[model samples]
Target: MGIRATAVACLALVTMGCASAERTPVTSTAERFLSAAGEGRGGQACLLLAPEAARSLDDCEKQIVSVGLRAGAVRGVDVWGDEARVRVDGDTLFLHRFPDGWRVRAAGCEPRAEQPYECEVKT
Candidate 1:
């Protein structure tokens, strides 16, 4: 291959790798959060939530579990900057990267026509 063509191919691969790296953590955080909540580990789930999201609930631990989150097979993930959306079998979750790591900002989301997603739990 020509040098220019090789460089372009290498750049494309690097870009794709970065995207995959970002998506992995986002997917992992969403799955972990859902699993924790679904399995009645409310405290663990709450710890995975964004600060403002956790504070939105009066009782973070109890209320997080009551949200009825489920851990399903992850179907898709989109990461933009420090924000990400993960779509699983029965749910979509939004998360933001923090200094510590990624944390769930919203969950149990359903799309609406010409509107933002309505989530059962959000920041």
Candidate 2:
């Protein structure tokens, strides 16, 4: 292969690697948040929420669990800058990267027809 072609291929590989690395943490955070919420560990789940999102809840611990979140197999993860969307078997979650790490911005979201998602929990 030409030198230019080789450099392009390497650049593409590096980009793909970066995307995959970002996705891992996003997916992990989403799954952990869902698991905590689903298992009635509301306090744990609340800790994974963004500050605004957590505060949006009248009672973070109780309401977080009562939302009926389910942890299904993660089907897709899309990360853009510090924002991410995770799609599981029956749910979609949105997250934002914070100084500490990724935190849930919205959960229990359902896509609407040509509109933004409708979320049960959001900030």
Measured with C-alpha atoms, the lDDT of residue 111 in candidate 1 is 89
Please give, for residues 3-104, the per-residue lDDT of candidate 2 as tens digits. 999999999999999999999999999999999999999999999999999999999999999999999999999999999999999899999999999999
Query: Which regions of candidate 1 fall more than 4 Å away from where they truly are?
Result: none
Question: Highest lDDT: which candidate?
Answer: 2
Return the lDDT, model 2, position 25: 93
TM-score each candidate.
0.97, 0.97
Candidate 1: the clashing residue pairs are: none
Superposed Cα deviation of residue 77, candidate 2 (Å): 0.8
Give lDDT tens digits, candidate 1, residues 18-103: 99988888988998999999999999999999999999999999998998899999999999998999999989999999999999
Deviation in Å, model 1, residue 98 alpha carbon: 0.7
